[model samples]
Target: MNILLWHVHGSWTTAFVQGPHTYLVPVTPDRGPDGRGRAETFTWPSSVREVTPAELAAAPVDLVVLQRPHEERLAAEWLGGRRPGRDVPAVYLEHNTPRGDVPDSRHPAADRPDLTLVHVTHFNRLFWDNGSTRTAVIEHGVVDPGHLYTGRLPRAAVVVNEPVRRRRYVGTDLLPGLSEAVPLDVFGMRTEGLAEELGLPADRCRSADLPQRQLHAAMAERRLYLHPVRWTSLGLSLLEAMHLGMPVVVLATTEAVEAVPAGTGVLSTRPEELARAARRYLADPEAAARDGARARQAALERYGLKRFLDDWERLITEVRS
Candidate 1:
């Protein structure tokens, strides 16, 4: 089967490409680090021709897998007329929270009668009405060894794209309180408002997007990781942190409640409780280490790349059936 995967999640491309069938990834015009545009146009597995009304019209695409409405307009272009392998299925992977009062069944992608929706977390699955949508839950998975060597560290960290809405989801405001008791680092796309408003010391806030090695290195720098999400669904970042042997101090909302077990970290409703748990991890490093070890064990057992691939294959085959 030739699948046209958008390859938006750069880190997961390896696993998807190595699966049972060939994957046709869309080429980007920007020839950056990720396999974007180049004159020659490299192809492996299979390269679905660059997305255009006419070019995509000719490609023998079996399925179009998307994570969101990012490519809705471009994808809609090739909706008409079929050649041979033309009337392919479309799959949308829901990777985050539902928008507004609208349910997943109302997703723009689901407007296509041939489209199937896949959710990455059960927390997200519940948000869908599923009246007009074929919904399936395929939780995020990670690739890990049987047991990982966890290093001891002093502080705790949380990863997020926007750091300013500190009080909102990702608990940006919690960081200042967290850093007061225990040192914390925020990694990923940073916002100036968060940086200016929160005024966490230079050591506390940053706008750094590190490589995989550096990301793991950042995780290894702390004994525990704080999730503290208030709005969004379970973030892939939390699972990555768990895989890195970091026990989390997260809010008991969304999938974090299910993702992090009692043995893994502390979950609570209020920010004060979260702050207390942060202190517990900070004061009792030994306990945090043990929790992290358990978290790593849980993460490896539940979320693995091979598992995700198998789940995806089953969904695709089920749609075929």
Candidate 2:
């Protein structure tokens, strides 16, 4: 299948293009948000090809995978005014949870019966009002980072992009308290001033914007992975960390409750409880490693790339047919 999709989320796309299909990604001169072309940080297979606006306009697209709401209009313009889902097969992949009016939050494509709304988590599917639009929950799948856990460093590791800006939503507010239990090594974009903003010393809450490989390597050295996000469809970073064989301490919100099962690590709604769990993991390397192994196994069984790609293949075939 010739799948037309934008490079919206890098990590998710990295695993997606590994499937048995020709992925057509958009490329602009600037390679901006709508047209990131190919991923630089993560490796992709030859099946993923970059198509310019003019090229896409003429190319035959088997299925259109829409991530952002604006992509519907963008796809029409790029496809020479072909209406997605109506003129061509299309699916709207909702990555984030609804923002306003929890119960009444209607999806933008809710009224479109021709399009299928794909939610990354069951929580998102339950929360979103799809109206007459068809919906499916595919969950999340990640390319395994391998069993890289060393737990050599006695600190905790966190991967939250723009932690300072997202604040409590990304669980940045819980970091300071967790830092009291175990020092945190933060990694992601726009996290440079996080230490100062959180009123913590530089050593306690150090931040770096390492590439994906380096980030995984650095995170593996830590005693445990910290996922404090209060609300999200599901975080790919959390799954990636588990695949890296790092024991996690996550806030039991959104889809995290399903991702981080009991005995894999600690899952708590209380910040203090999660902090205490982090401290325990930091203190006991053997315990951390035991849980980390469970985490790796669970991640592979639930979020493996093969299953993800298979699900997508079936969905695309059904939609296209």
On TM-score, the leading prediction is: 2
Candidate 2, residues 30-139: lDDT per residue as tens digits?
99998889999888999999999999888998899999889999999999988899898999999999889996899998978799999999999899888998899897
TM-score of each predicted structure versus truth: 0.82, 0.98
RMSD after CA superposition, every candidate: 4.4, 0.9
Residue 199 alpha-carbon offset, candidate 1, angstroms: 1.7
The lowest-lDDT stretch of 10 consecutive residues in candidate 2 is 228-237
Alpha carbon lDDT at 26, candidate 2: 98
